[model samples]
Target: MKQTLVIGASLNPSRYSNLAIHRLVQNNIEVKAIGLREGVVTDITIVTDKINFKDIHTITLYLNAKRQVDYYDYIISLQPKRVIFNPGTENPELYKILDENKIHYEQACTLVLLGTNQY
Candidate 1:
């Protein structure tokens, strides 16, 4: 199974990041959630830091562009096969870095991808 790291994950039921967690698990994708807020979703506790991540196949971002700057190095170091910039999370600078690293990137919604059977 492809292991995905859900950046900006939240325990709030109303949040897209939380929804992504549910959707990813439903799709049989393993998920590791990283966020400042700590709580459980579907019996899995959300991790607060990305420093120990390894074998990340994909990273689906839930954070907006401005808040993403501080995480650039962290994300890049994960060396995932791809990064999905869902909706409001798009960043050209980050895209450039991913491009330089030969990492695949897509600016699209994770929900849409799951709904469309493209995830």
Candidate 2:
């Protein structure tokens, strides 16, 4: 299982980000949830500090494209092999940057991919 980092994770069960975290765990994928707020998801701590991230294979975003500018550098620094845009997160500028850095990415829903066994 690839270690996935869920950016913009939330504790609120109503949120899609939280549902994605649950789905990620259900699929047996190792996950590290990161968000500005602090809370737990799937019995795992939602990390806030960027310094704690390592060995990340994928980064599935839950944040909107407009809120992503500040994270461009931090995300690139993590150097994940791929980053999934996850529905409303699609950003052309970020995609361009990811391409330039040779990082693979896709604009799709993580839950759908997992459910369809295409993740």
Candidate 3:
């Protein structure tokens, strides 16, 4: 399993980001998270700021296009194998940026991918 980073993570259990975190852990994948507020989920701590995560194979986004604007450079800096634009987080601008940098990405649902054994 790829080591993943869940961006725009939420502390609320009902949110998909939260569920993804739990699912990723259940599947025995290394997972890190970044959210507005600091918190914990299934032994994973959600940080409030970027920390230059290393060897991140996948970055699954939970934020909308607008919120993602600020993360463009930060995401590229991490140099993940690919970025997953989950549902509403899809952004054409970011896609272009990633493409220019030679980073792979896909607009898909993280939960669905996980459920279907595709993640």
Worst 10 residues of 1 by lDDT: 43-52
lDDT, candidate 1, equals 0.89
lDDT of 1 by residue, 2-92 (tens): 7999999998999999999999888888889988888888866798866667899989999888999988888888889999999989899
Provide the overall lDDT of each model, using Cα atoms, as 2-decimal numbers. 0.89, 0.90, 0.95
Question: What TM-score does structure 1 among the candidates reach?
Answer: 0.95
Model 2 per-residue lDDT tens digits across residues 79-115: 9999999888989999999999999999899989898
Per lDDT, the best of the predicted structures is: 3
RMSD of each predicted structure = 1.0, 1.0, 0.6
Clashing residue pairs in all predictions, respectively, total: 0, 0, 0
Worst 10 residues of 3 by lDDT: 85-94
lDDT tens digits by residue: candidate 3, 4-117: 999999999999999999999999999999999999999999999998988999999999999999999999999999999998887999999999999999999988998999
Residue pairs clashing, model 2: none
Candidate 1 scores a C-alpha RMSD against the true structure in Å of 1.0
State residue 10's C-alpha deviation in candidate 2, in Å. 0.7
lDDT-best of 2 and 3: 3
Cα lDDT for residue 1, candidate 2: 65
